[model samples]
Target: MMPASSATLHVVATPIGNLGDLSPRAQEVLRTVAAICAEDTRHTGQLLSQFGIATPLLALHDHNEEAIAGRLVARLLAGESLALVSDAGTPLVSDPGFRLVRAARAAGVRVSPVPGACAAIAALSVAGLPSDRFVFEGFLPAKAAARRERLQRLAGETGTLVFYESSHRIADSLADMVQAFGAARPAVVARELTKLFETVLDGDLEALLAAVQADGNQRKGEFVVMVQGAGDDEDAKVAEGRRLYARLNEHLPPSTAAKLAADLSGAPRKALYGG
Candidate 1:
């Protein structure tokens, strides 16, 4: 058994879905900590109850994280070991607790990680996309225009892109992705991961959109959307050319727009003009 030291903060990763995924080390840290700082006290309370752990729970979510961080840091400095956890998965990976971790570090308190489950990483492991180089874009903007704008910016990215999305907006988000990244871009939609109804669907953007639209069930769970990155230099050039063509086509004829976009982006005019 490892000894819990004073003036240390243990960052524990809980289960994303299946409770069995929580590591033995994470459970040990949770039991040994002076207290567990959670995004949702009640939710974490339930988990602790299952394990018969009696450690006290303290709420520390986004709204009051800044205010609570300082006090928590003081406690850590005063020799009270604490554990930080989110509702599910790793803390600070689209969840809260960054401020507390940062504060503890600044106060010269040791902050340690008991890593286990992370939804993004979990999804990426089975995504079948290029995982060597990828980007995790937490949650996109809630608004359609903002989300589309963000997708447009990422359209040219060469590394695989991962995103967390809610069920309510999955359809619209996929539609926006189809528009921004093109219908043929390979993508995967992993839903309800590690849960009873876990589903992982992979296909071209348009096909995936159709699958989701055809089934209401596909739109009912938490989602991790992984999009294959732009291909080689030639593929990137074509993507850039298409983006430019989209804008210039609005103000110029199709042939003229294709020519200008190709010249500016170093793409082939024949490819842009569909020749």
Candidate 2:
């Protein structure tokens, strides 16, 4: 056996949907840890109950983090090993365990990762969307105006964009994406994930929007939305500028429109002006 100086925090990844995905080692660790810190103690409690793990649980979430980290670290310092878990996926990822993980590390406590399912990665795997180079944008701002602005900011991101969204707002958000990213942009929507009704719908921005509208349940669960990266063709990029310049012909002046269109469409300002 190895030597033990003191206790450390274990950052574990819980199943996103399928309970069967929980690894055996993770199960054992959860059962024996001095305590378990979870985003929602009740939810984690249920998961632990399923596995017959009786470890004590501490509720650690966004609202209570600052007040909790100090005491949690002290417990770790006192040789109380703990496990940190989000409601789903890896801890500290769009979840509320960042402060504890950071504090534990700062205090020289050992940190171990128990890797498992992540909704974003899981969605990407089955989405048929670009995965070589991608970014996970946890969730966008909720306001329609703010969300649209955010979508505008990411209009031409080169890598495929992935974001988590609530079912209630998925339709509106997709519509905004259509406005900012274009209706014809290829996209995919993965719903419910690894659950019994897991669904993945693929289409352009508009087509997916329509499909979600037609099927009432399309907007009924956690959603992982993936938007394709900008087309790589230099000529196509130039053509995009031309199209935007045409739009600017109505809303703005030539020079101003050229800059705006270039920024939005990622085209050459000079080429847009020339066209």
* CA-lDDT, candidates in order: 0.91, 0.85
Q: Note the clash tally of each candidate.
A: 0, 0
Q: What's every prediction's RMSD, in angstroms?
A: 3.3, 4.0
Tens-place lDDT per residue, model 2, 1-275, is: 33133787889999998999899988988988999999999999999999989999999999999899999889888888899999998887789988887887888888889999889889999889778999789999999878866776666577889999998899999998886777888999999998989999999999999999899989898999999876666645755665676567678878888998888867889866864
- lDDT (Cα, 0-100) at 125 in candidate 1: 98
The residue ranges of model 1 lying beyond 4 angstroms of the native Cα positions read: 1-5, 244-260, 268-275
Model 1 C-alpha lDDT per residue in residues 1-275, reported as the tens digit of each score: 23223568999999989999988898888998899999999999999998889999999999999998988888887789999999999999999999998888877788899999999999999999999999999999999878977887787789999999999999999999998788999999999999999999999999999999999999998999999998888878877887788778889999999999999989889867874
TM-scores of the candidates are: 0.91, 0.87
Q: Quote the positional error of residue 87 for candidate 1 in Å.
A: 0.8
RMSD of 2: 4.0
At residue 51, what lDDT does model 2 achieve?
Answer: 93
TM value for model 1: 0.91
